[model samples]
Target: MTWMDEFWRLNAVFLVILLSFSFQGAHCELVVSPVVPTLVKAAAGSTVTLAVSFSGAPDPTVTWFKENLPVVTWTIDSSSPPDIAPNYRQVLRMRKDGSLTFVNVTRNYTSNYTMKMTKSGLGTAVTYFTLLVFDNIQNVELHLQPDPVKEGIDDFTLQYVMSQGDVEQQMWFFNAKEIKTDSRYSVEQNSLVVRRPKRSDTGQYTVKLENPFSTVETDMNVTVLYGPDEPILEARPDRPFYLSGDSLSLFCQAEGLPQPTAVWVFGGENLSHDGVLNLTNVQTSQGGNYTCMVLNGQTKEQRQKNMTLNVYERPSGNPVCSVQSVNRNTGLQYHCLWWGGTPLAWLSFPALSNTSSGAGNFNLTVTTSDNLNRKTITCVAVHPVEQNQCNVTASSPVDFLPAVRTTFDLGEGKIVVTIQCVSEASPEAVVSWSKGSEAVISGSTYQISNNTTQLEIRYYNVSSFLLQKYACTCLNPLGSRRREIQLRGPSISDFRLFPNQARTVVTLTWEVPPASVVTGFDIQMKGPNLPSENHNGSQIRGSSNKYRTIQLKPGSARSADVFNLDPDSTYRFRVVPKARITEGKPSEVQILGPGGGLSGPAIAGIAAGIPCSLLFLLLLGGFIYLCVYCNKNKSSRQTRYPVSRAVEKAITAQPDSTPHNLLTGGLKSPPDYNRLHQTPSDRSVALPTFVPPQPVRVATTV
Candidate 1:
């Protein structure tokens, strides 16, 4: 190699050794003195300090850690260094000697504290310290003696107590205001007392107990009791007076600390022990002074109330009903009365309020009618418990008689006879009709009215026999009455035949009936052989005759002509008046013939002479010769010669020894044609038969 290279290599080795020596001289070793302990104790709100010394060249960096976390770090700075952060600088401070100081330590600062120191180009140094912080005093409490203080009776006391802590000061407050101890109120170490505590002393009281580290406060409430007010008395009826049989009740009430009880007294006698006193159906004897006493159980105080009750009597009796007077306008007056009732408002009746007098009497006038006759008058006296009553009935009598009337109506070719029977009775009367001796049943020919007061008998083309006597009888529960009325036809009078017209055309003239009640006339003519008879045998009448009816105007009195009659023949005639209901009695008969006054023998002789001219000549001649020769010119001789031919034959044909002379012949065979034409009579062959002539009857009525 070259000289220059070797020389430089030697110089380099020398510089390297010099540089190693210098580095070894500049490096400093770490040394720790005054080691920190594991645990340190401190009081709450007190300061704590931690100190440490460490040696190292190129100054070592120091830092603090708790549970391996960095707490504080200290380092040397050249220029313009940043300020320490607030959290670490507030509670802890770093010194130039690498120690930490904690000011006013609390429980939160009781964890492990670590210190670290740092220098340029050197290793770091750290120290740890554990802290415990405690407070000896705790939360304060205030208690009260006589918790519910009774006002005017209790002295109040407030006691204060606390935990194990050093308390430096204690203060008292009432209602959040500072309280200074005085004569009225005083305080001890843990209690306060008030002398003669009034209701004003009942309020909230507080005690503030504090140590060097903490302050604590507590509150207590006090209450007091007071007195009740005076008692008040009340009554249910609200009135002091009452009538007999009234119900009464009393009440006693009061407001107090404790509820009050009542005692009731009547006229100095204790009656009840509750707050209410009730009396029912009170009498006059029970009326007196009543007192109610109220007492408080706890306060031992009492009150009294007094009242008086008055009872009056009410009148009672049975009501009396009497007939007062008869009123001209209204009728009968009746009055009801009761005497002397207190507060008459309680007594009542339908007519009481309308009375003319105020003496508890009622009057009413009733009319005399069917309603009054059946009515019962009543008087009522109303009372609270029961009602009094009195009643009377009215009496009346029946006062009328039966009346009968008959009416005739002619209409529609018929005649209606209405007979009405009526009577006035309290109860309606029943009426019945009787015709002659027989009862007239209603309906068909007889139609009775609804009330049986009227009966109507109807006839069409009525005849004389229908006229009759009718009796009407009316009956009720009280009595019976009868009335009779005759329904008569027209009266027939002056019945006769004209003498001049008696033989040939007989013109019979008759007077019309007296009344116009008749509508027609019936003419009955009986021949010599025929006869007519009526209902009764009072008049001579003959049956087997000819009848003819002739209508005439009503109310007319005139004559009728009858024609076509036989000559020298005897006839008897009668006329019956016809009405709407029936017929009247026939007129007396009149005989008409050739010689009107001739005897039956003369008539027969004349009739016999009418037949056979030869016998007529013989008889006439014989009669004349006898009259001349025998000197029998008397009326008896004339009568004896007038024998009918049939009688002559019977007399002449008799045996000679039969004792049949002229007188005997006259005695045995007198010739009345009706006697010879009997229903059963014998005739002789020698006598010629002769037929009696029949006449045409033409009857008319006016």
Candidate 2:
């Protein structure tokens, strides 16, 4: 190893150490405030301060620079020397202190300046600051927002920015109050916003600000812009609507801020220079398209829209009438209107509502026949153009004649019971009587009378059992009306009233049948008791059931007036009522008073007595007389024996033979029997029939 090499290595190491120490004390270390640094703008005539500190040196030489050029330098007796830039002035003092000052500032003097110093040559230090100087300051620009607003817009915003010679340097003021960005007043970049602008926003807005170094704050007045509101369109007199052949007119009108111009349109066509539009006469074609236009003069805007016009025509034409089905008493009616034709009109028919219309509406009405047949109605419409015609038809309801089965009772063992057949047929009805299922209306005991619509059931003795099913049936030729009859039990109301009294009021009552079967009630009552109850009683005739009672011998039983009655001094009472129950034969008397002369306090009667022996003999004699005398006489006179059917046919077969008697089983053949029987009285039913005569054969003994 050489000593020179060692010595040179030591020198290089010492030099490296010295350089490292110097870097560590100055350039390598940092000087910064935990407090943040800020930039301030100063007006041309204003001044501002900056803060600086060092993390490396406590006392060092300081120098100032404007921007990248040096401005001043200071040293503690060469501790920090002073340096300066051109066109700017500054003075530096504060011996051995770090404070520095500037005087007579100018606009260009404001800049970001840096200073550097060394601590006794042990360290080098540097710092950056803003040196702001103002020559003069002006107003800050303020923006009052809410432009292009509706009438009565209340809210607005006042905002400003700071400036030295630029708009960004100004701040805003509202009514002399400074404004900043916030919720109600916000600045989007530079434009200020005022939410919910209303009438209350009308106020003063001024901007005032200066650079951070300036003392003066200047303000500028601001104003907002508003508008003309929406316009409402109107028309003079009325809207353009007319009926055919009528005069029509319309005018455009509008209301808005600032005068508005109005225009009229017909079917979307603009109107002429004159304000009014006049149509001398209107037609159906004029029914469509009308409009109005409104132009706001202040806003310089126009609007137009269409409306509608309706034209109507007077009602036109009348309806037509026709007839439908016809019957004896039934008829039909029909009506049609001249609607839905050219010229578009309406029609009304009052007569139809009153006369024919009652029966005929849109449809036709026909009267029904008594035969229950439906009647047809027809309607015919005749138009002005003879060829134009319409027709319709309808049917009338079928008619139903209501009728019923009824009965009447004549009190007695042999009652005159009637089976009444009734119905509301158009013509008088014909009735036939029957016993059970037997057709007895034409027989000897039953005389069928078409004139009265009844069958007289007589000649045969009436018995209780026989009355059970005796029926009378009535029918019309058209079969529209039909009814049957029935027989029923009896009604016995009163016998004798008070005995020894002068005349008595006989209380009479009877059972009536179904009202539907009978139109009215026929009634009769009688007194006196029969040998058996409900047997033979005082005769009671056809009872026209009305009065409840009839005056009679008040309290006594009469032997003299006792025939179809109870002669037993114990009086009986019987009644026959018209409507309901038919007499099923004459019923035995109902005993109302005591047997043996009337015994009740008010009833009295005289009785005749017969000896037991005489009664036996009289009964025996009477029985024999009836059997022998009546039978014998009947046999001797029995020639054709009640006109038997055989004899009647024999005689009728010979047309040339003259009928001996209608009751003698004699007749002449008639081709049309119905015509021969009872033709109209208007016309003679007596007509002749042609038939060949057959020889009468005598009974031959062989």
Candidate 3:
């Protein structure tokens, strides 16, 4: 209590003295001026004033404070009018009205300020002010960690940096539009984070920094480099195949920032660096996988696409040609084809009548003509791109005409001549034998036989009547052909043998054989002393005594002379005819003696020889009569016709069967009347009836 009272007594005494001083200072009237602002705002790096005006009788002193702490002190002087003593001299100043001013305002200068004005005779007056120095976003800029946004990628940071300023509020803008925070985008103190940026998030990014006193903005452009979405490569033709000499073009496309670069790769090698690849002439070797690669420099990302290209060629070689139809009426039809070609070209048959087949084939139709066998048909096919052409040919078969062949047999003293026709045909041909227009039958005079492709005619007991025209016909469904033949045999007449004066050699003579069918002759002779029992000389039986066979050389003389004959002995000679295929019977034997004349029994022989010779003459006359009559009516008969002109005579008269002196008796005699030609006109002259001459025997010198 005692300490409290002592403290109160001192406080009361001090209070009484302070009241007296306040009364006296109040009468002096220290007042601040009116119309002064208590708060101030300013831009960073710019001047601002906290206005403090007073109406005091004496100028008041000013003191500045920041955050309730003393900052600067100022007073008015009559000479200087204002004074300043600031904690930071370059920042704060004092005016005569007790107001505070900032020379260069910054964010650090934003605070509450109080100005205290006092004088010796006036009461104390204080003024309060708040200074909001806006940091005009100094050096405020929006920045990206990668500078540009990466499309389809992870988060990217967008930051705003201020060199010297404080921001109370901020707003982000993209392309002048405000940006907000979302799952894809976020906002931190001064940065904007974009999570998983897409291609759509590319544009100008702006930041608006605001304080209580001022507003400012900064902008930066954000580019989102998008990826080349599986770069698309396409061909100009758009087809999967190309010809070897065709033109081709390829285009590569992509979307990206910084204008992505393009690369084309083929067969593991880089082919082009442009967005489009052009090929003037493509080849088969140029076929392979084509790759298009697009690179984005800003994003450091690449995309690629691949396409397969193929080059092909048409088939090249000879075409296949086959016969489609063949017949007698339509001749031949051929089909030409070229298969397995990529692009089939038109086929043509230049030498024939060609028609197009619906497919890549050609047809040729031909008609029968005389020149068809001599002409050739060719088929040609050209490929679209091949250098060579396909060519083929067609031909017909052989065998269309008839050929005739003939043969003869002389086994039983009579001749049998056979004629045959041969030919070939597709279908079996019908063969037949005919005389003139009438078909020949299997009968006595003519025997006809026929097979599929041949005709045979057998003539039995051949005579002048058998030497007639015979025809062989062969026919098929397609066509027909015929062949004719006139067959005959040899005819020998005027047979004689004369002995030389020395009686050693004898010459044999005869008329040329009929029908040139005689190929040769065989002459037989026996010695005067014969082994046979007959009184007249007879020929030896075996081949041992036979004369050497003689061949009729094509153009040699017809006479054959015999040498080494016995002068004083009787000899016999005979002749056998040789034809194309057979030998004729031997003629009657003739007798020779040392007198170079016939040697035989005269008196007895005359008695028999006359009758026999008479009979021979009768038979010869009758045979000649028959040959004439038959030849005259040959045109009317089916199996009769004129024979070949090669025959000189068809009938020969022989002596009677008694065979003595051969009826001449070795004497030079007159021509016999019975020796007449077998034809009518040649023997038309009336002749005396033949009479057997008396067989007079002349004695031969021995």
Best of the candidates, TM-score: 3
- The residue-by-residue lDDT of candidate 2 on 532-559, one tens digit each, is 3234633332222222323222111121
lDDT of all predictions: 0.59, 0.43, 0.62
- Residue 264 of model 3 has an lDDT of 90
Q: Give the per-residue lDDT of model 3 (tens digit) for 1-702.
A: 699999999999999868856775665466664255666767778887777566545545656667777766655665653444445678877666666778877777777777676666566777777777776446776667865667767688888877766788888887887878888778788898888888788877888898765577878777777876778778998886888789989999887777789999987888889888898788777877889989987677888888888776675555766543356434656577776555565677766644543235766666655454424455667665553434433333334433333334446333344455555443344567778778877776566564534444444333543457767766543456776766555545567777778867778876543333444567766544333333565533322244434324221235677775555565667666655435556555666754335344544455566667668766766876786566546533444334432222322444333233333344444334345433464443333233435543433221
- The list of candidate 2 runs beyond 4 A from truth reads 1-60, 65-70, 79-81, 86-99, 121-129, 134-190, 193-260, 272-286, 295-302, 315-343, 346-702
- TM-score of candidate 1 versus the correct structure, residues matched by position: 0.23
Q: Which candidate would rank higher by lDDT, 1 or 3?
A: 3
Residue 285's lDDT within candidate 3 is 76
Best by lDDT: 3
State TM-scores per candidate.
Answer: 0.23, 0.33, 0.36
Model 1 misplacement above 4 A: 1-139, 165-189, 199-205, 236-251, 258-702
Better of 1 and 2 by lDDT: 1
